[model samples]
Structures are given as C-alpha cells and as structure tokens.
Target chain A: MMRLITSGAGALLGGLMMLAGVTGPAAAQGTGSATLDAVKTRGQVLCGMSGSVPGFSLPDSQGVMRGLDADTCRAVTAAALGDAAKVKFVATTTQNRFTALQSGEVDMLSRSTTWTLGREGNLGLMFAWVNYYDGTGFLVKKSSGVKAAKEMDGATICVQPGTSTELAINDYYRLNKMKFTPILIQDQAEIQGAFLSGRCDAYSTDASALATFRFSQGPKADELLLLPDIISKEPLGAVVRKGDDKWFDVVRWTFAAMITAEEKGITQANVESFLTSTDPDIRRLLGIEGDMGKALGLDNKWAFNVIKAVGNLGEMWDRNITPMGVPRGINNLWTKGGLQYAPPLR
Target chain B: MADTHADPRMSSARSSPKRSMSFAWSDPAFRAIVWQVLIVGVVVGVIWYLISNTANNLAARRIATGFGFMDRIAGIPIGESMIPYNPAEHTYGRALLIGVLNTLKVAVIGVVLATLLGTVIGIGRLSKNWLVAKITAFYVETIRDIPLLLQLLFWYTLLQGLPSPKQALRIGDAVFLTNRGLKLPLLVWEWQHTMVLATLAVGLVGVFLWSKHAKQRQDATGVRPATWPIGCGLLIALPAIVGIVLGAPLEIELPVLRGFNFQGGLTISPEYFALLLGLVVYTAGYIAEIVRSGIEAVARGQWEAAGALGLRSGMVLRLIVLPQALRVIIPPMTSQYLNLTKNSSLAVAIGFQDIVSIANTTLNQTGQAIEGIAVIMAVYLTISLSISLFMNWYNAHIALVER
Candidate 1:
C-alpha cells in the first residue's frame, strides 16, 4: 500500500513536471523509436484517426473526436499517461496512415487500420490489438439493378486507394471472372459523393463504414443499397512502430483490460462499487492483487484508471456506434459468442 | 572586362599583374576560389547530413528499405492504363510504369492543347475589337488568379451533375456522354488497315524527300516547286487508294450498355477528362501571357516592314512576326510545360492515378517511403530534362543568325 502511494505520488509529480514543460516546442514530432518517451515528455498522445469516419473517429458537433476509435485512443492515453483527455488526434488518410505511424508522426494509429500479414511482415509496425472485426462490403444505388457483388461485372467502383478494398475487389472479381474499373480517391467525402452522384456504379469499403456513410445520408439513404456481399475479413486495430516491445505490450494490455472489464460486467459507473468484490479475477484486473502491472512498468491501478476514464469496451461501443444504427454483432464480448475474446488478465 | 573597376591612371599597377601562385587571403583569385569551395562544401555537407540522418532514423524505426518490393504483386487497380495490366499478375514495377504512362498521356496532350488555346487567346487579346480583347483578357486574368485545385473540384462537380448512364446524352448510337465518361465507338482494325498504314508511312517518307528537293531547288534557282499538293496526293490519296484496293471497310464497334457500363467502346472517364481540361485551361492562362509578351516583343516596325514587302497583314504576322516571336516564346514555354507536368500530380485529389498517386499507394503498401519518393523524383527529373533538351534544340533551330 505504501509502495502504491509513493508511485502514485511520483506519477503526479511527473505529470506536474510535464505540465511545466508546456512552454516547450509545440512542433508535431515524428521521431524514431522510443515513442513512449516522446509522448510522456510531451504529455500528449499523438493518435492517428480517420476523423471523417462515423462511429469510428468522426468529429462531433463541437469538433471533438467522438467515436469508438477515438475512445480507444483515449483508453490508450489513460493507460500510458493516466489522463484520458491527453491525446491529440491527427487525421490520417488511407494512404498516409501507415507512413504516419511508421514515421512517428503519430504514436498510435487507431484509425480503423486492418491487420494485414503484409503490413506486419513488411512494414515495421505492429498491430497491437484488434478493436473491431469487420468485413469488406459494397454499397450500390438501388436503381442499378445489381443484386449481388457477383453481378458487378464490368462495373466501375469508387474505392479508396491504399486500402484492402482495392485488392479484395480485384482478387474477388478476377476469381469470379468478373472485371471492374476502380476510381481511386483519398477524401472520404468526395468518394462517397462520387457514389451518390452516380459517378461510379458502386462504392466498396468496410461494411461498418458503408453503414456509417449510409446513415449520414439521412433521408436519401433509401436510394442506396448495402449489398450483402462481404468480400474480405478485416480485423481493424491500432498500430505502433515496431521494435518497442514495452509500448507494444502496453497497447495490447490496454485493450485486453477494457474487453476483460466488459466481460466481468464492469461499466464505469458500477466499477467503483465493485472494488470490494471478492472475485480474484476482478481484484487482479482492477490491480488489487498480482504483479501484472509491474511487468508493464505501470501502476497496479492502470486498468482501473482506463475503465473509470472511458468505461469498458461495450460502453464505448454503445456511446459511439449505437447511434449509427449498427448493432453489436461480432464486436460483442467473447462470453456472448463474439470474436472479441480477451486473454486472461492474470 | 574583368578590370572594368580599375582606374585608367592606375591601370599599369593593376594590370592583372603577374600570375602569382600565392595562397594568401590577400590574393583576390585565391580568396574567390576559397569562398566558392567553402560554399560548395557546405552545400554538399548539408546534403550528406540529410541523407545520413534519414538513413539512421529509418533504421532505428526499422522501416523497410531498398527497391526489392518492386517485384511483389501490386493489387492496385487503375481505372485507365496505356499498357495492359492485371493487378493480381503484374508487379509493382509494372503498376508504376502504367502510372508514368498515364502522366505522359496527360502531359503530352495537355501541352499541345494548351499551346493552341493559349496562342489563340493571346492573339485575340491584341485584337482591334474591344469585345474580343476584353473577353480574352478576362479569361486569362480570372483563370490565372483562381487556384487550379478549386477549378478541378468545380469541373468535377459540374460533371457529376450530368445524367446517369440510363438517361445519358447520346449522339445517335455511336456516342454517349454520361456522368461516367464520354463513350465513343472504336474502329475495328483489320489487315487492310495495316496495309494502308504501311502505305501512309511510305508516303510520309516520300513527302519529306520531296520537301527537301523543293528546298534545294529554291536555294539554287529561286523557284520552289509547290510541296503541299504533292504532300496531299502522296500522303492522303495514296493511303485511301491502298485501303480501298485492299477492301478495307469502315467497321466500328459501337458501345452497347451491359450490366454496369458500356463494354465495347473506349471510355474517356470524367476523372481523366476533367484533369485534362483543368490542366489545359489553367496552364493556357499562363501560356497566353508568355505568348502575348513574345508577340509584343516583336517590333511594330517589323510588321510594317513585312507589309512594305507587299505582304498582307495576316501573311506578314504569320510569315515574319510570328516566326521571330517564336524565338522569344520557346524558352518560357518549356518552363510552362514543366509546370503542367508537375501539376499533373494533383490528379491524386480528383481520383486520377498518376505516378505520384500510384507511387503513394505502392509506398504505403510496401513501407518504402524513401524509395517511392525517389522513384517519383527520378521520373519527373527524366521527363523534365527531356523536355528541356528538346526545347533547347528547337530554340536553337528558330534562332536568328547575326549574319
């Protein structure tokens, strides 16, 4: 107990020192490895986000990032710096996201980036944890008379470049002996605009993103049809520059804590009441026992801070994604027969 | 010339006096050489520092380096390609080559079209009629002032307002212009057409030989034989007769609407068309200014002199003033051409996959940012230098001889 108090006091002093360094250079630093030192010194987590993506990282009416992905960035900041709001969101594109993370432009890319083998094996970046399980889908206009993705032969597709959408469509069509012309654009608004204006026959992206874009259409959503073809499996997650094993483990355990919190029935409001619960799993997860946080070079209360700051993963999804009318199907806890299975916290 | 600052009375003392090999700072030549070497050394040192710093940072980050990824399969699908490409089968190198080709297609066609439009507008700006001059002047002023990117977006938006393929604007059965693109019938080529092409090539060679003969005749006897009538008969009439003899029919494949789009015809997508239109229109505004200044630099007396030689106003402007003006026009025109080519990189914003756009995708996919940037730089450098060399040669060709 004395050790916890001293460490907590030390962290507070560190935070104050960081605040004192506020007069330091405000330049966006994207340096080499040891990104943790930079984030701690700057007292802010530079997180990459696709701010145009709804239910993921879209900006709210107040211009604050409000989405599942944005909340994940907050959770990461809480674990790393003990402050949920101490993250600076840098808007990234499909093309520049990986480079931004690799170049240290952003310490964490929680931008709906898929965990691909190529990215892991080639790019010096690690997919710390899968936040959302998704699949590639096609959205076409209802008047196009196209029923299945199979019937999209000889079609022009408006797909964002530097995404799995392009590759999946190409391989899927080629395997089916179909053909397509891709209209590549970087801006999400423009790409969606192209689809609505009938510039391309179909728009191809993630199913979740397609739903978000359709929901954004308000009344005109009826004109667009979200086809039932999921061409590829996309496990979306945050990425950090590789070779930083400590940072990688910290990011991994941060998501593990949130998902574990959801499984253990710990919402932010109910979490305080359950600090006295006798469950050994609960005590260890909340940092009551065990040396789990010691291995991470963090305080035992890191997981507790994360939940208290941003709630569990389920609460985050409810706040960010439920308004978009997308039900929690595969993103539910493993106990509910979803893919979001967290390894035992102990 | 080097001693221009020396006083005449003090010239004997300063007569660039004895070529001394002293390395002292007092020696002006030695000081000049030292300063130049120091500046160059600093420049080279800074560049080396940048390169080494980048290498160290990239190594520390463990980002992949080198160009070996070029052989990897590039699953990027481009909307348009000059060469046949299969995303699954082709390598990244092939995809980059297609990007280079797409860039060249826009640049070459843009250069030709911009020059024609700019020359016309430039001449119109100098017209005696106030309306023509003001309208031309207005176009140049407004277009040059507005950003090219905004104009591209406006053009893309305007194109999106066009009807869908179902209710497309059609010119009979052979052509359709929809929001998709301009669809036009493609002529089906056969052996007969190839024969005609071969005949046309022979005719072109013959026409060049005839023009050379005409030039020699004019030089010797001052009586040049007419070359155009011969050029017409040999070039046009000969190809027609050959084609007709070989029973070449004008067979064309009209575009038929299939599941999602036209299948048989050539589609000039709105992305490419808008990019082409935007680039030509914007670059022409600058080109028009260059052309106008070039024409104006030709003295009014030169035009009167040609008129005094019994030439009509049109003939005098075309035969004398325009040729002289071209000598002034070619140098600046080359820079504008380079600008247009570089500006083509903006195609990324509008969904046209040029070298920069495709290379960007490749780098992201491969994690070779430095190599990808290097490829783009090398391609642009090669293209720009080629243009510069060609323009330099043309400039020398049209230069006036002092004699």
Candidate 2:
C-alpha cells in the first residue's frame, strides 16, 4: 500500500513537471507476420488505392479499377490468390492511407505513393518496389508566362497537404531564397478547382499526376504547361504493413516478375506460348525448372499467374500511362536506359 | 417467566441458522455494497483489458509509445503563425505550440466579436420596427439551420472566387481584398512600443482600482459620482499622451501590390479568415437566442417600477433589466464560448493549421498516433478547463447574495 501511494505521488509530480514530455521511446512497429496466412484464408486481398488520381488509381464508369497503380494490386492478388479478380479495392486519401494500412483495413496500398525515409523509419510500413519514378514539378497556365519554377517566385501555389508535395515546395523556395505563398488544401479535387479558377498561380505536385490532371481536368491540353524543372525526387511505389516478411516477399517478387517478364519479352498474350521456350531463364521464371515459389511458400505457378494477370511492366504502362501523355521516360526497364531493373529469376 | 419472555426473539433467530448464512442477500445495505463492488470490478477489468491490448498492439507494430518525438524537427511549413516558426529550424513541439496559439487567436477574437454581434441581433429581434425584427429572425433561422462545415466551405469557396491580387478590390491604398487574403496596414513594432503597451496595462489597472474606490464612497455617502468619463480618460487618453511623448513608436506599414501578390502589410490568409468568419457567424446565432431569452427572463415588474420612478426606457433597461438579465445570460453564454472554441478544430477542413490539424500532420508524418492524440487532447482539455474556471468565477461574482 505504501509503495502504491509513493508511486502514484511520483507520477503526479512527474506529470506536472513534464506535462508535454511522454515517457518511453516510440515503438516503430507494424502488423503481425500472420498477414500472409490471413490473406490466404480470407480468400480475397484488400488493396488500397487513391480513388481520384487519373492514370494512377481511378475507377471507370463501370466501377472497375483501372490504372497503372491498380495493376500492381491485381498482380499481388494474382500471385497470392492465383486469380486477379480476387481483390477488393479500398479508396484511400493521403491523410488516412497509412492509418488504413496499419489498422488492417487494407492488405496492401498501391496508390502511386512516394517512398520516403521518414515514412520507412516511423510509419511501420515497407515499400515493395518502385513502380514509377516521379519528381515534383509545377503546372501553370501557359498564358501566365511563367516559363520555369524559378520564375514562380512570389506566386501562390496550391498543393494537397499531408503529402511530400507540401514539403518539396517549401524546400525549393527556401533554397532559392524566394518567397511563395502556399495554398494548402486537403482534397485533390479542391486543389484543382482552386487552380482552375485562378485562385492559385500554379499547381505543384508529382510530374505524372500533373500530366494526368492537365489531360483529364484542364480546359485544353495546350493551355497548361508542365514546367521543365523537376524539383524533388519522388519514387512512387507499392507499400505494405511492416513485420510480415513473407507477405512483403510475395509482393516484392511479384513486382520483380513483372519487370523480369518485360525484360524477357513476355507479354500477357505471349506468356502461355513462352512456356515451351528452351531458354533456362524463361523456364526458371515460368516455374518449369525451379523451386522459387516453394521458397516463398507459394505454388510453383505464382510468377506465371502474375505475368498473365497484368502482363509485363511495359504492357501495364502502355495500357494506363502512355495514353495519358506520361512517357515511360525513367520508368522503363534498365536495359532500355531506365531504372526498372529486376534481379535474375534464378 | 421473565426468561421465557426474552427468549422468543432469540429462539426464532436460533431456529433460522440457515437464513443467517444468506443474511447478505436479505440485508439491503449488504446487497447494495455487493452490487457496487460487482459494477466497479467489471469496469476496472474492461479498462485493464483495453490498456493491455493497446500496449500489445503498439509493441507488435514497433510503434513507440512516448512524447520523445516532440523534439524532432518538423519539416512541413506553416503558412502563418502568431509565434516565430521556421519549418527547418523549429521542433515539432514548437510547431504544435504555434498551432495552439493560432487556435487561441481565432477563439479569443471570435468569442468577442460573436458576443457583440449576438447582443445587437438579440436586441434587434425585440425591436419595435417590424423590418428590423423580421430581418434579425431570418438571419438567426437561416444561419442556425445550416451546418457549420457547409458554411465554412461556402465562405472558403467564395473567398477563393474573388479577384486576383493584381486586380484586387481596394479601399484607398492601405487595404486590399483579394483571393489570397485581406491585406491591411500593420502596426510596425519597435522596442519602445512594448513599454507604451505596458504603461497602458498599468493605466487600466489604475482605472479599475479607482472605480472600486468610487463604489465604496458612493455606498458610504449615498451619493454616486460619474466614473465612466474619468475611467476612459485614465485608460485611453493617458496612454495616448504617453505614447506620443515616447516618440510615437507605433508606425503604420502599408501594403503594396507586388509582382504576383501584395507585400509589406499583414496578410490574413483566406483559410484563417474563412474559419474565423464561420465560427463567429455560426456561434452568434445560438448566442443571440440565449441573449434574447436572458433579456426576456428579467421581471417585467422591475422595468415598470423603474419607469414609475421616472426613469427613461433606456435608463430602466440599464438600471433594472440589464443587470438582472446578465445573471441569466452569462452561464449559457459561457457554454456558447466553449462551443466556439471546440468548433474551431474544424479549421482542419478548410486547411487552417489549428492545433488539431497540425498534430494530425505530425502524427501522420511521425506515425506516433498515441502521442499525437494525447497532445491534442491535453491542449483542448487545458483550454476548456481554463474557460470553465474563469466563467465559473464570473458567474459566482455576479450571483445574487440575499444576506
């Protein structure tokens, strides 16, 4: 009883002295390793996607998910469940995406999300692979006569907050010793609305997103100009809750298979025909001659299913992004002078 | 025979030994104690279970549970703040502090403006002019019916639809109204200005003491003296004279149209303006109803008596109705003020970085959900308690004492 009383009094004094200080170090934790078995048992994988960004993760008029980011989700589903259709897409906002993943609301997030060290360190989430190489850029009306970002000093830039886009602009302005007004908004639609109405001088976001926005929402494609300058490096990718090494490996290898398929000249149409090829790499990747799937505790046909569902990386890009005026540029395979490199299938 | 007379009750008690074993079930006090213990035990057990579960989840996720992250540098830029803050230099703790100050800035100014506006509308509702009362009623009905969030969105959208800075609507050269915000001339601060402000505070205290002394004299002599003009002279005129003597330290900084926007004056971002306007306008609707009821609650006989003593209608209101009405108005008005303070958290919806909004960003950036939520709660709790304590004191001071 005396010990309890003393401890209670000590807590009161400690609370008073450091009302702002919380005791103990932060635990950078993630979901349990049971996610792999859980997803298999549930019979469907829950995939998180940004519901509004065009060419990335928007639903069609028929309510079917279709985008470059959406293809990643399908690939994951195909690898895990052996059926691309065995997936549910949950729309997520920038503010609540991490929370959704952490709370087990979604199995994986493939929302054209940027991979950042801060998120990796503290968010208890791991990036599976960089599916898109993006960078922060500015979008302004061509008629505004703002040719470059440096010329945009003293301009009001509208950005959706709670994203890396906000911090990138701040750093750019501060480093240039320039002053720019930031109009922070929560919704991407609202930011576009504000920018379209001339409330903001320019809209700042990822270069690919800017292209999608301009093509989908602008009055005319020629009226808006995406500036030549790329201010911040933004490698957009897929993310999963941390601590599930098997689940992470499943997603990671599925991504690698898509890239490897692209490298090996395999498309969704030709994947079945390639099964008879004598190439050892093709045989190993197609699971005709290796225990790669068994090592990850999956069936031998996992990589083959992923390739058939989403095609190769190049095919996915051509289907979703190429038509939207976003070139593969740096996102092409390393053999094609780009950054998308996959390890040997063996 | 005497022993037999005493033995009947004892004999019955002895005969019912089985009943004695279950005495707690029959005894009301004992049964009440048992019920209380059971309820308390269940509540404690549930709470313990929840805490342990949360701790387990945090440990499993590797998300640390602590306030240590407050010291980390906050890299996100705040558009504006009442305190000095640099995104690259200040810690998350400082950023949150600035957020708290911003919330207070809106709430304090909002409460004052809402009260003044509400008092006028309440009196206007009681006006003899038919148009005045009808318009006031329409305002109260329309504003109170719509949700505050919708009102905030409407105001923000409307502000965003205004002309660009280069083509801003201006009143003279000192003020500009544009989509960016309201640009007003700022008072350029110098070191001497603080001294002048301090003198003004002292003068205000002096006036208060003087008024108290006058009240005492009036009670002793049965003769009241005019204190309002003297009080104003000491509080305002004296400060002005001293300020001028100190070389007129307050200087005006006028806003000028710069390349893409205005520069040199105070810029009230549209987000802050919209949030302040929404909170004040919505709260004033409820406050007006409270004020009207409080005024009506005053006894009609008191007004009649004041008029019977040859007082004018205005004087009767001031001397008989208002003092009494204030007693009823204050308690409910305190609640309206509290509601306004709490409602200011909606600043997040409009992109105004209030404490709740900034802490949310901090938590998302750091992924310290427990710490972030605890900080936000502590801030609101402190604000709520302070307001309540002050209001309770004011209520007690004004309460009637029939000794």
Candidate 3:
C-alpha cells in the first residue's frame, strides 16, 4: 500500500515537473552561461544578505538598506558594473543562503555568514574574504552578576536555532561540566524578547550581534552586560558559488582594496585625489598604472568605483557599526594588531 | 418526419456510405488513447529535461549530493527530547529521530485532548441551558477565527511574562509556575516500579479478554453479563493490590528552587507548553463544530425511540446517537487529525524541536537542502499515511450496514 501511494505521488510530481519545464524555459538559462555574463545581461548584481540584523543588513527609515552586508553588495556592484547603486539585495536566512546562491537565485551572498571547512570544502561555496572577525559571546542581565561565561554554569540560555552559536554554547557548557538548559528560538525578535522577559538567564549569539541587540532593544544598554569572554572564532565573510574563479577574484579583491585603502589613509573623500599620487602601488590600485582591472575583466576604475561608493573599510565600519557601540577591536587593520590585513595591491 | 419515415430504405442507404468510410477521429476510444499517449509522452519528456537540468546545475555548482552527512555529528542542542540525546555523541540522524519522536508526542497528546474537549463542548452546544449553549457557541466562534500561529505566539509571550523562577507561583512546594517552565513533582522509581508496570500490563490484557468473553456469553445465552465491575477489578484494582503488596516503590521528586531555576522535577518548557496549549485550543474549536454537526446528523426519531424504550439519556446517546453519528464524524475527524499533525510543524516557529524544524537546522548546517527536505517529506508522508490507514480501518468497522 505504501509503495502504491509513493509511486502515485512520484507520478504526480513528474507531471508537475513537466509542466514547469514546458512553461518556464528561461529558468534553465542561468546554467547555460556564466554568472558574470548573466549578471551583466541582467544589468544588476543580485546580492544575497541577512536583512534583519541591526548593523548588518537592516533597512533604514527611508527604506534604503544600510549595514556592512549591504555595503558589501554595493561594493560588488560598483566594481562589476561601475554603478554601486545598481544592486538588488535578496534577503536570506541561514537556511536558504547557500541554496539561493547555487541555484542562481542570487549572484553572490554578502550576509555575515561564517566561513567553515564544511561550507568551503564540501558545500561548494568559497569564502572571498573575512570581512568581519567575530566570535560567540553570552548576553546576561547586569543583575545576574555573571562576569564571564564560566560563571554561567547552571544557567538557562536562549540561542537561535540552526546557527553556529547554538553549538558553541553547548560546547562551552559541556566542557565546563555544568548542567544548563537551552531555549532554542528561531526569530531574532522572539529571542530578544525572551531574554528581556527573563525567560532565559542569558542570550547567546555573535558578539557584534549581541552588542547590536543589546544597544538597540533592551532595558537599557547599561542594564545588560555582554560577557567579555569570546569563546568560538566566527570568521564572517562573503560567500560565492564555487567553480567561478573569475567572479571569486573580483569579489576577493574588492574586499582587499577596501582594507588597503583604509591602511593607506585613503578615505572615500580622498579616493579620487589619489589618482595622481606618486606611489606606484596607489596608482596601480586606482587603475592608473597596471592592468589589474583588465585582468578581472572589469573597467579600469573598478576599485576606484568601489571606494567612492562604499568608502574605505574604516569609513564603512565607522559609519554603520560604530553607532551600535561595537568597537573595532579584532576588526582593525593588520598593522594595528588586528586580523583584517588586505593583500598587497600589486 | 413523415417523409423520412416513409423513405427508410433511402435513409439507410445514405447513412451506409458515411459509416463505411469513417475516420478514426470519430472513434471515442481512439481519441482517448491518443490524448493519453500525448499527455504521458509530454510528462516523461518534461521529467527527463528537469532531471538532466538539475544534475547539470548541481554539477556545475559543485553541490554535493548524498545522504552521508546524516552520520556527521549534529552539534546543535535540542531543548526537549523523549529519547536520550547528547549533542556531542549523537549523529544528525539521531537528532532528527528525536525530533520525530517529539513531534509524535505533541501530535498524539494534542489529538486525544482535542477530541475530548471538542466532544464535551459539542454536546454542550446542544444543551437545553441557555448559558451553556451560548458559552460553547462563543468559544467555538472566538477560537476558530484567530489564526493558530498568532495564537501560538500569544501563548508563548504570555507564558514568558510570568514571574521569574525565584518569584514563581508555587503550590504546596510541589508545583511551580515560572517564566522558565511549569515544574511538577515526578515519580522517582526504584526496582519494584518495574514489577508494578508489568503487573499493570498483564491486568490490562486480562481485562480485554474478559470483556470479549462476556460479549460472547451474552450473544450465546441472551443474558448480558455485567463486565464493568470485572473490568475495574482486573485493570485497576488488581494492579494496585499487587503494586501495594510489593511495597509501592515510587517516590516523588518534588521541585526545589536552586540558584537561578527549579531543579529535580519534570519541567515542561514554555515552548512545549505554548505549543500544546495553542494546538489544543485552536483544534478544539474545529472539533467542537464537527462534533455538533455529527450529533445533529442523527435523526431525531432514534433518540425519541431509545428514550421510549426505557433507556436513560446516557445509554441512549451511547447506544443509538453515537453509533450512527460517528459514521458522519469519523471521516472529517481523520482530516482534523492530519491537520493537527501537519500544524505541529509550526513548532519550529515557537522553538519546539519538531521533525521539520530539526531537519531545517540540519539542512542549514550541512547545506543539503534537497536531502533535508526529502527526509521531512518522507517522514510526514509516513505519518500521514499511517494515520489515514488507521482512521480508514476504524471508519470501515463503524460503517452503516443495510440488511
């Protein structure tokens, strides 16, 4: 009986698949050509992003998207099409981000997604660059007197389901030989609400996100404390479908140019003036000396366009994340004892 | 008409020429066969194209396709599980099974409670007392209108707003209601509890056999045997006597306040509490309506006849109204059962680790969208099919017979 029913269902799905194939021939066109060619033909860069994090990809009061993830999308568009504003941001959750990219639903993903071995090795995605250096942290009420995560033994923690941070919390608690209960909530708003209402002893997520939520929605930022102990390393970066090295390099270098511009003291306001600089490295990056832009099949002013549109990495950070009270600690340039070092422009 | 009737031979000769050289298109069987062939051909063609397209796309994108990831360690923690699960030790497959068990737990409990509550409310809707009838009507009207997901969210939020654990509402130090959960004292069992459990199972089987024998004797001798007392003695009293004789080994583990929360009791987390309350409350409304209509489907003459024959109201309902009304209720009730099972998937929204939610997490972590969704689909299909088969069998047994 089960076999009969399953076969009937299979046949029905086949009929539907046939109908879909006949009616929508254009759906297969993405596979017929390269993603770069498709994006150029479409005249817009389709950028996948996490759309609700406060300082990551949330929309502003004017309905325009702002944040680090959103700026990354604009940077890609600026480099590829020489028009930073000509990009469409498709909001994705942790669940569907990779599928969306692999299925040609989006050109590239700029969500603050963590780069991991499974994702890069077996999941067929390549991390372009580590745009943000983040780690998991715990959020507890100030009155709880939980100075660090080790003190959070026997505490009930609320963490978002299906994220790396959820695992990190379990690992932290288990390794410490402490028994703790977990409340796994999905929506960000619900988790924050639960934490605020004292349904859980603490909320756990990326440290920057914890800061974003604490400052944005709370009993007041001072009433809540973000524990100083960073447990697991979460290198959040942009991801793209593998097997497209050309598109990968374009994205990777766009990130590199931003960091290098910040290290060279080239602010967005001062980017255009560097075209006449005597430094060969600056000239090569600005597309005034070398064939770097030609090598990537982009225009000579691709890096310049990215800088002009989203500004240097420092300016991007100072504008979007600084207001949320997230200090640029490990996210600082390599010369300042930080992990964010861009490759040499040459 | 007179001319055509008079010239029958001429009409027959004229139709003979048309019939002798008829086209195959005029044959209905031929037309049906041709259309069927065309549709099947088109379907096969499309399936082939889609399969190749997907294969090419997956290859081009380098997305791995297999079920090997199921064995990988699922590092994510589950809030509540019926089976033993450790995030460090368990595989993703085990986590998903735990999720399936949790889903079943909610679905089975929800179905039983909803049926009982619905039947009571449904009978109340037909009550002679104006207040009882009107209140039931109001309940059905109010509950059926609000969306279930919103109701679930409301319940979760309401539960979360209760006092913290330290200031929890306590009853006799055994039950505590806090924002964290409802803590209730649970049985802490020793070795003798197993003997009690085994004795109870044996007693239940004995009760079933006794009832069957009683029915058979009544049929043969035309004298109905009283089986209720015998059933109570076997199923309940027998087990209780034996358990007590063996020294009644169950001990209560009452909840006590620890530093931040209650410990040493059976805790029903807010997510499970909210999900159960929402599912039961929402589904009871529909069930109530079903029950009301099912009872009404019985003819008024049956009730009147049963009452006139000296049967009491309870006996009349049990012997006449229910037997017939059930035939109408069973089919729709089966659908409601399926709906409740499917709706339990919404547990993910409230942070309940149902099969769908866990599969989604696995999908997200492993980046295996197709395989994860396939597992969900297969599990739901099995559940839905099993429920349908059981209900269908029951419906067949209770189906009306014509002599």
Q: Which has the better DockQ: candidate 2, or candidate 3?
A: 3
Q: Write the per-residue lDDT of candidate 3 for residues A1-346, one digit (tens) a residue.
A: 1222222233234333433333122332432326666777889999998778989899999999999999999998999899988999987666666766766668899887888898887678999998789999988999887898888777888887768887778888779877678887676677788899998999889998889988886458899999999999999999988877778888999999998898888888989889889999889889998988888878888899999999999898998899998889989998998888887877
Encode model 1's per-residue lDDT on A12-85: one tens digit a residue.
33223322332222343332226666778889999989778989997888988889899999998998788898
Deviation of model 3 at A305, angstroms: 1.0
| Local accuracy of candidate 1 as per-residue lDDT tens digits, B33-143 | 999999999999977866666666666566667899899988889889999999889999999999999999999999999999999999889889999999999999999
TM-scores of the candidates are 0.91, 0.89, 0.91
What lDDT does candidate 1 reach at residue B316?
91
lDDT of 1: 0.85
True contacts kept of each: 0.70, 0.43, 0.67
lDDT of 2: 0.83
Q: How well does candidate 3 score on lDDT at residue A179? A: 68
- Docking level of model 3: acceptable
Ranking 1 against 3 by DockQ, winner = 3
Question: How are the candidates ranked when ordered by DockQ, highest leading?
Answer: 3, 1, 2
Candidate 2 per-residue lDDT over residues B279-302, each given as its tens digit: 999999999999999999998888
> How many residue pairs of model 3 clash at the backbone?
0
Whole-model lDDT, model 3? 0.84
Ranking by TM-score: 1, 3, 2
Tell me the tens digit of each residue's lDDT in model 2 across A1-346. 1221222233233222223222222332322336767777788999988878888888899988889889999999998889999989987767667766776668899987899998887777899999899999999988788898999888988887678988899899889988777776666776788898787899999999999989995558789999999999999989987777878998899988999999989999999999999999889889898898877767788999998999999999999999898878999989889999988778
